[model samples]
Each structure stands twice: as structure tokens, then as C-alpha cells.
Target: MRQPGRQTRRPERRIPQSAAELARVHERALAEAAARSAARDSAAPDDPPFLQPRPEIGDSWERLRRLGLDPDAGAAAVHLGPAEIEHRRRASGLDPLLPILRGTLVEQGEQPPLILAIADADGHILWQEGERGLRRSADRIGFFTGARWVEERVGTNGIAAALRAQRPMQVHSAEHYLRSHHSWTCVAAPVHDPGTGRLIGAINLSGPAHSVRPYLLQLTATAAKLAETELRARRLESLHHLRTLAAPMLARVNGPALVVDAAGWTAAAAGLPPPARLRLPAEGWGSTAVHWLPSLGECAIEPLADGWLVRPVRPQDAVPAVPGGSDGPGADTAGPGAGLLAEQAEGARLRLDLHRAGSPELSVRGAAGSWSHALSPRHAELLLLLATERNGLSAAQLADALFGDPARTVTVRAELSRLRRYLGGLLAHRPYRFAESVLVTVAGPEDPYDLLPTSSAPAVRRLRAGLVGGTVRLPGTPPLPGPRPRPGRLPLPPP
Candidate 1:
């Protein structure tokens, strides 16, 4: 669309000399962009390079436009109740680190004191502390504790944007999609679970637009890192306690065995190579039951003081013997060949219960006996795709399927590798899939829209769309059904 020899000017890449001036520039640029967008006109060809919004800001603005959000609408007023807020605070993993965050961000008492808020992954502000005057101002805009700030609810802002992007983010002045938030500047960084890399919440700093500082983004990011470090350290301490308790228990075991914390981190091992972690049953290991562990095969799991003692069942032997020689809590007494005979009669079967979004379950029945493993959201997605395809999915194919980016094969491979640890021989590599000998079935919600409600993957979105339109059906499985109750826990065989 440009004449020959004329090229679009690129925005400057150098750091701005003054934060206040940069905020002013962004405000002007946003005003012009908003005007052009509202008028349905392309950006003026002769606009100055400084008039262009940053790429992320521009993208957010476009998304808001597509969603038909009103730039002039007052800030969203919905907030979680007090009871819900308290529950989230306790579960956010941030409560214990509140003192650290307050020390790092609040007690420093910078001039023009800033407001610090911590929000859960869902963007509900779980805690807020700062200058009294600033807190009062924030309260007017529904930015206090218990308020939801996700982009979908309140338009573009740092806390919601950072959580959505899973990274550090800054919003200054009119860069906010909602005009109601245009007077403020904020920086936020997402905090993730140290063990599972799941997003837990975000650390946010906000103040008047005039208070915008180049260092605030880094400060927030540093606070988030510190919180994660503390969380990891706490987990390590727990593992240490578990190791101390497990040492004596595993010493008395007869064969290959290990002890692991609830999150599956190995604390100790005997007669085997200790994997750093093991995938345990989703609902957690029952104190008196034998479970099928992918890495260890059939395992008799005994509850230790702070961990579990896992002993592998030998194929030649009917049961894994307990330390006391009595068929006790950690003993498998299914009798010789009981599991093998069941496998021979029924073969291997995999049932994916995906009717519930956040609680996906995978049940595997075979020579090792039947057990259900709770699935992470990502794992559930991978299994759904594999179950539907039947022919399997290469890393590249799966990368494209999940992320809409084929170049993300490395991420796909890493996740698949973790899954293989939980699946063992039941899963095959090359093009990843369930082994040919396994029969896979998927149970889904009757309302197609309910399928993986939390997933934003392109493939899943498309499948949901097709299903709602009656153009698609859950392939390689029986017809979708209404919400079904989860099966009761399998009764442990009598001791």
C-alpha cells in the first residue's frame, strides 16, 4: 500500500529519558489509536513513529475492540464475597510470603507511595496494601481486595494482562483499554507453582500515572521471583522431613522401593534408581492399597509419616510382601496371577473421564490392576487429541494442535515425556500415542461447550465450535453423555 521508495517508519527502540514524558507520549498515541479505531480508519500514513503503541499494548487494544468492550465504561463492579476472598488467600500460596512481599514492595516507602496488590490466577485481588490515600482511590475503581481484574471482566490492566500472558507486563496511562483506568499506571508479574509450573497468582504495583517509573516492572518481577524461591525452599524442607521419616521404612523393604512426598518428589529409594518424581494416583495414594505406578509397575503403597513407601510387585511373585510378613497395609494380597489373568481376559483399557473441566481423570486397567490417575489440564488435552486421532501425533503435529504454533515441538516433546513417565509401556513414542494393544475411550460432557472449559487451545476451540454446530462428534469413542458421577474409590482387598 506504500509508494515505491517510501517505507513505514519504525518506532524507536531506545529507552526513554523520562518516565513521565513516556507516559504522556503513550497517552497521546492511545488517544489517536482509539479515535482511528472508533472511526474504522487505518492509522494515518504520516503519523510519527512515537505515536505507535507498543506491540503488546496494540494487540491488547485490538482484542478489546474485537470483544466490543466500551472504552468509556466505568470499571467493572463485581467482586468476590468475603468468605471466598479468605479462601483464596489461604490457598494462593502467597499468604505465607505476605511479609516478604510487604517488606520488598510496601515498607520501602518510596515517594508518591505505590499500592501493592496480589491477585490469584483468576485475577481476583486477594490482598492489597499501600498508602491509605492511594488505596482509597483504588477502591473507587474496584481495584481493592476481592475485585476481579481479568481482561474479560475489566478490560486491559497489568494484573489481568500479566496473568493472561504468563509474564511481566506494564500498563501506563491511556494504554489501558478502559478509559476508567487511564489515570493509573501499573506493573505486574505472574507467580507460578514451583513444582508444577502452574500459574498461582500475580504481584502488582500500581499508582497514579505521574508515578510511573521505569524500574517498577523489574521490581514487581523480582518480588515474584523471591516468592517462588521461598515456596521452592519450603517444598525442599518438607522433602527433607519426608526423607527422614522414609529412611527407616524403606530400609526394611525387601525389593525395589522408594519414598515420595505428596507431590511425587522422591525423598529416598532402595534397590532401585530413584526417579526425581513419580506420578501417583490423582486422588492420592490410598494408605492400604496397591496402585499401578508407570515407572515401578505394580506398587504396594504404604503411608509413611510424611510420605509414601512404594514397593514394586514382582511378576513371578503373587504379592509384594510387607515388612512384618503379615498381609498388612503395604502388602498386596491379590494372589498369584490374579492381575495377569484379568489382563489376559480383558486386555488393557484406558478410560478418559473429561466431562469435568478441572477434574479430568484417567483410568487404566491392565495386568497391574486398575487405577485412576488425576490428569493435569495439559495432559488431559494431549490424551484427548491422541484418543481422537487414533493414528497418533508427532511432536510437531501436537505442537501445532495445542498451541497453533508448530515450532513449539520442543515444549510438546517435554510435556509428552512427562506423560510417558506416568504411562510407561501403555504409551508409544515416534508419533506419540497409546500402545496398539490398549483400547482408549473418552467420556465427555453432553453439552459440547463444557468440554475443557479452561483450555484456550486452537484445536480444542475449533472442536468445541464444530460440536456445538452439529458438524462434529467425539470420534473413536461412544456418544457424548450428560454429567456422570465419578466412580467410588475401589475398595482395598481385605488384609
Candidate 2:
């Protein structure tokens, strides 16, 4: 409360009028923050109510310190060879967008020159171009093609920070963890695959610290967005091409049929409502052959230039004849569909070989013969959850069980779709589970704790910790009467 005769004075915020002044202010604040961090026992200490490093920069500094990185390290070494760099450039999805990035950030020829660098998801610089003097400066710091700029290698920098945060970021002067980079300023943004939402690479605009401006962040971000837009347009164009080619082929099919691209985007459909996409098997359409599909029973697949044509077999064409003569005891008494129904009831046999630590395989034996596929760590975790819960699990439930976050339903669905492509009709949806007729059997390691050794999913972790209540016994092994003991800590039979 102010006295009637006097007025209270509030501190006024002072805004820097030029980039140099701003840099000076940032340097002072960073010095104080760095001093505090150095004197503290913890990598991350509470910031006082004063000018300090931004949250992202502070977090990165903390991470670098925790990783035991030397702040005075020299220029980062280029670890990627020329051949490997070329391969990455072609596969990065950024190579084609170089022209757009150059036009937006490089070709501008602004007063204070800057360099443009593109790094793949792994933080290896694939391309860099800019004003001649600026390029030389960048080269002096090993900011050339094939140089790895990830935090683990070069300490905190724009490309590494943007990729780590999965967003646009700017690192200026002392904000960089390495003292060698203190004279440089960089602004970067991560680019993602529009179709799959996977980070492909990052675009960065960098120059001497004095050239840094607030607008550089937006400039880099705009360049990254343009690259994503181009990628999305190209995807749409490919889908259109597939659609045009599929029209006549789908028209000639008599029964339910559809055509889909390699990524499972539907191009055309006949005799059925077109699904936005179908989950194709992991092996994909290796050759034109008959394959069992979860959504369409049995389908004959024909390979196209860029996609596949799938036609479901009609019921009359799919049914097999009874083995015995019609005069046999039950043959004559049964209807024409009895044998098919019996076969359907018997279903398929599924065997999960998870006893080994690193090699997990799923084997299925049915009317189509036997085949097996190696399971990725994530797939193995999902299968384990489904096998344990015989009644099945909803998308949300599975998401919660796997990630400890029920809101990650989309991630759960995507993974399950890939799993279904290979499993075919053996797996079922609408609360994902093995088909009722599938004879599901699991073979875990002799030690329950050794199950899915590489899995970190919440469900797997809980099961390994003996937090899940159940009698999990391997085939021919006696069931433990009570809760299972954690592996490595106690002697226990495999579940």
C-alpha cells in the first residue's frame, strides 16, 4: 500500500534497441547462470528471479553437463564418411527440398550474410551453403557436410536442440554449450514427414553472433514448413497417379477389391466401401500371390508399378470339399458348409518364441502353411500384452498399458496396423486380440524377469517386476502358487 503523500515506483523493463546490445545482455545473463550452475551440486538448479538463460538453453546446458561434456572442447569431428553422407542425403527426404530452402533463406542475400545448413534426424550435416566468408567461418568450426552436430558430440547447438525439442529453436552466443561455438548464432527448425509424422531432418540458418536477429527464427521455421508442404504435395501427386492406374483394373474385378499404395493409402475400390488405408503386411506385396487379409478373408494380390491390386476371394471359390466320401458316417448327415465351418472353428496355431533375449519370433501355422517373422521390440511388447489378456484390449487400454498414457491411441493404432499386416486374419480388432479360434501359446525365458529383455514398455516392466498378478507358466511347467519373483534377484522358472 502506498502512503497518500507518496507513490510507489515499479521497475521498468528495458528493451535492447540493437542486436549487439541484446547479445551483450544475453552474455551477461548467461555468465551469471553458468556461474550458478557450476557452483551447484545438481546439474539443474532453480533460477533466481533475475535475467537468466531461456528454459531450452538451460535444459540443454543441464543435459550436456550430465553427459560430462567439456565446455572448452574444440571443433566437433566429422564422423560420417563421404559415401555414407551421400547415402544419407538421398534418404533424408530433405535433398529434394534443398532448392526451396536455398530460395527462402540463402538466396535472399541479406545485408549481414548467413549460412544455411541441413542436418538429418541423426544430426549429421548433409548440406551447407551460404556467403563465401560465412561458409569459411562455418568450416573453421567443422560445420561442414558429414559433421555430426548432435548434443552428445558437439554440445548444445541449434540443429541438435531443435531435433531434441521437436520444434523450432534458436541458439545465440553463450547459449551454446561449447565455448568454441560462443561466437556463432544459429536458428533451426525440425522438418517432419507429412504422411507419417516422423522427423526427417532440420534446417538451420547460422552466422556470426552479431548477425543474429529475432526474425531469423521465423525464417528458418518458414523454410522447414515449406519443405514439409512440398513433401505433402508430392505424396498427394503419387496417390493421384495410383488412383488413375487403379480405375480400370478395379473395374474389371467381379467381387470385393481395392488398390492401395506401398504405404497402404487406398487408390480405388470396387464392391466395398473404400477404407482410407489398409494395413499391408510388413513384408509387403513381395510377389503376385494369394494372401490372407484380416479385413477381407483371402485376397489375390497383384503387384503394380507403384501399388498393389487386391481382390478378395468369393465364398463359393474359397470353400474346400469334405475329405471323406458322402457316404461316411457324418459326411452325409452334414450340410455342404459343415466342413468349412469346422475348419474355421479349428482356426490357426500361433507360437511366440520369446525365450531368447534379443531374437523374438512369431510363428503361425494354418491352411496357408507355416511362416515366421522376427518381432521388433515394440511388437514383441504388444504381442505379450495381447497374449496375457485373453479377452482383448481396447485401443485406449492398450495405449495406457504400453505408454502409461491413454491419450496415445493414435500411436497404438499405427503399431497394431503394422502388426496386423503380417499376422493377417490371425489377429482381430474392435478391442484388439487374437481371433477366438487362434490357439495362442507363449514361450518366455526360463526366468520371467528375462522376458523381453530389451522392452521398456510399462506393461512389460510391470510384468518383469512381478507387479502383474497372474499364474504365468510356460508350457509343461508347473504354475507358481503365488506371485512370481523378479528375475536376477531370485531363482524362478520361466513364465
Candidate 3:
């Protein structure tokens, strides 16, 4: 106990930076980044000021610029049309978290309201709600539902930063790369798929810069975690229900078999060790779907009470292994074995149409049937890059092609994961490429400029040059433009 008039010490917390302080620090950092750019003779005198940017921020800026964004004249908020927005909302699984997020951040009848916006993993804001007045203010900056807030499209903001970091983040005052956004502050966190651990989207809280406090970041982070917890709970409940249904079915089957839920988790298994996990299509196959599962070749699937019943088409293939290595039954399904089975499938064909307006389209012909899905912008670009490579590229090489940064393997991997889901066994890993037996064809406009207009990769540029110059020739198709190269140096034909 303190005695006399002496005051006792109290714990102190780090104070939130005032708007002016944030401006100063950010200005200095941006000036340093700008100075470095000037030293390299890559920056023009009239370039937009970049406040001191974090490394992630700097990388984002570089990618945006390479994508043809103009810092000085930033993009208008681009929103998906109504139908597309609806499609994303249904798929995002973020709807359940909205009430909790809103209740936490918004008061019953608060005077000045803070905006809560939720964006898909690609940074498209699907939902935004707040006070009437604040909503109007948000509208001016395209913070309304449907606006795209990706760093590449808009610049530094919490939604983009959080998505890139795969964690909660805050962007305040002049920390925003775009001058228009400096007057606002935002905190956001990425939401992930509980089963797949894939980023699904982000949730953000935004308001005037003065309203920001250091604790807001933590608040948003906690909210995000709570949301993830909810997802885990929901998944466990689903698995529980699946198990109850599967128990009855499992007892009836004698051969090695398993019952999997819609998302592909093993609900129950008998006479064999279960694989760690599996993935199901967004929609169920009418009565059944057949796939070449890893290690297990040509398995037949029939709709179960809750999920599906998986059994080997060949009775011999379903025999349980002796719980050990190569000599055992499950040996072939271990580790990279599934991929080996995929490689064995023959006569697979992949058709890509680059001439289609907006985004390119992909259709893969497999043993089941032809399945088609529209490619995202990044997917289209990656496929184009890989299509150009005679030998497949390593992850690092693909990263460099997609982002112009070899270090962005995680981002590359995520995009590839989405692509693989659409194509199934048609895609191969190790050095990522189309399957060996896949016959890939790219249909493009006669003019090279019309080919993959959204892609800025150096390889794409070279492809345009080759097509424009007639230096490249497609097998069984007319040659591209430009003067022919000498016989020995001619570009290799597409495989």
C-alpha cells in the first residue's frame, strides 16, 4: 500500500495515433518509397504520393500498376451486376455472421453510425449496412453493396489488406494509398472455409478517421474468429448428423466402403482406413457420380441419406491394406498415389475459348462427361501462361507470371486450387500443368490484341507478338502473323 501523498503508478496503454500523427508517419513512409522509385528512374514527378507503405502494401501497388491501374486517376467502384451479386451471396456462407457483426458494431439508435461491409474473397463488397446518413456518405466512395474493394482495383484499404494478409488488419487516415480514401478508416478480417481452410471473404468496419481506436482492430479480429468458430460448429453438427445416417448404411455393406457427406468428410467407414478428407461438387450429381479417387481408381458414388456412398467399381480394388507400406492393399492410395491414378486416365481433353467476351471459358472432357466452368480473371491468365509453356512451370514460375512476383506462392496456390476444383483430374501438380493426356486448344480472335485482353503477363505479350507476326503456328491450324523465324528457331507447336 502507498503511504502519505505519494501517488500510485497506473498501467498505461498505447494511445491510438491522432489523425495528424498518422498522416506524418504515412507521408514519411510514402516519401521514402517514392524516393526509392525515383532512384530507379521508374517514377514520374507527377506520380500520386504513396504514404509510407507496408511491404504488403508496396507489393500490392506494384501489382496494381502492372495491371494497368492509374494511381493518379483511380478506378470508379466497379460492382457486379445484380444477378452475379446474388450468386456470390448464396455461395459465400457469410450470411450467418452478418447479424452478429451488425449487433456488435452498431448501436440500437446511435447518432453517428459506422458502416459494416462484407466482401467476397476477391474483394467485391456483397453487403453493406449502416445509419441512413452514413450510408449516403459511403455511397459517394462506392462503399455500397456490390462495389469491388480489392487493393488492385481501389488501393490500400482494410478489406484488401485483410484479404491479402489472411488475418485482421486496419487502415487508417493517410495510410490508404488512394488520396480519396484518406479521410476514412477501416478494419477488416478474412473469413475462411472451416473444412478447406480457404479464404471465403472478409468483413469490414469503416467510419471517419477520428472514430478509429487501436482496439477496433482487435474487435474485428475477435469477431472474425467467432465467425470461424461458428463455421466449425456447424460443420461438426453436419458430420454428426451424417454419422448417424451412415452408421445404418455402413453396417449393411460388407466390402471396404465409406459414407461421405456433401462436402466429402467421411461420416463412417468399415473394413478400410479412411482418407483424411474429400471435396464434393457444389451441386449433387443426379443419381450418382464416378471419380478416380487418389490411390483408389474408378470409384462409383451414389447419393446417400445425407451425402454419398463411395465404393470401388472393381471389388478387388476395395480390399483393405494391412496398415503398412507398398505390399499392403491401401499402398497405392497413399501420399501421391491419387495423382498417379489421375495420370493413368487417357484421352482427356481441355477446350479453352479466349475469344469469348469478358472472361474466357473452360470445358474439360473426362470419362464422366464434359464439365464446364467460367474462368476467373486470374485463372484465365494462369491457364494462358501455362498453355504457352512447352514444359510445365514450377509454382514459383507461375507466381511470377501471375503477379510479376515470384514470392507470392500462396496466392498462386489458392487460385490454382479453385481451378483444380473445376477441372478435377484434368489438372496435375508437382510442376502445375494440364494432365499429360489432355489435349488443350485455345480458340482466339484473328487479331492478337484480342487474345486474353485482361492478361498482362510477359508471356502473354510475347504470344500476342508471335500471333501478330505469324511466327507461331498451332498444329492443324493456320499459322499466326509476323515474319517466319528460321527453320531451327521456330516456336514449338502446342502439345
Which candidate has the top score in TM-score? 1
lDDT (Cα, tens digit) per residue for candidate 2, span 29-93: 44545575532233245643234455456555544554667777734476789899999999987
For all candidates, the clash counts are: 1, 1, 11
User: When superposed on Cα atoms, how far off is each prediction in RMSD?
Assistant: 12.5, 14.9, 12.0
Score candidate 3 by lDDT: 0.63
The 0-to-1 C-alpha lDDT of every candidate, in the order given, reads 0.67, 0.66, 0.63
Per-model TM-score versus the true fold: 0.64, 0.55, 0.56
**Where does the lowest 10-residue lDDT sum fall in candidate 3?**
2-11
Which tens-of-lDDT digit does each residue in 364-416 have in candidate 1?
A: 77765566755656778898888877778889888988878999998788667
The reply for model 1, stretches above 4 Å from the true place, is 1-91, 107-113, 121-123, 148-179, 182-187, 196-199, 208-219, 249-257, 286-288, 311-348, 351-363, 371-388, 392-395, 399-418, 424-470, 473-495
Give the worst 10-residue stretch by lDDT in candidate 2: 1-10
Candidate 3 — which residues are off by over 4 angstroms?
Answer: 1-52, 80-87, 107-113, 279-290, 295-298, 313-495
C-alpha-based local distance difference test score of model 2: 0.66
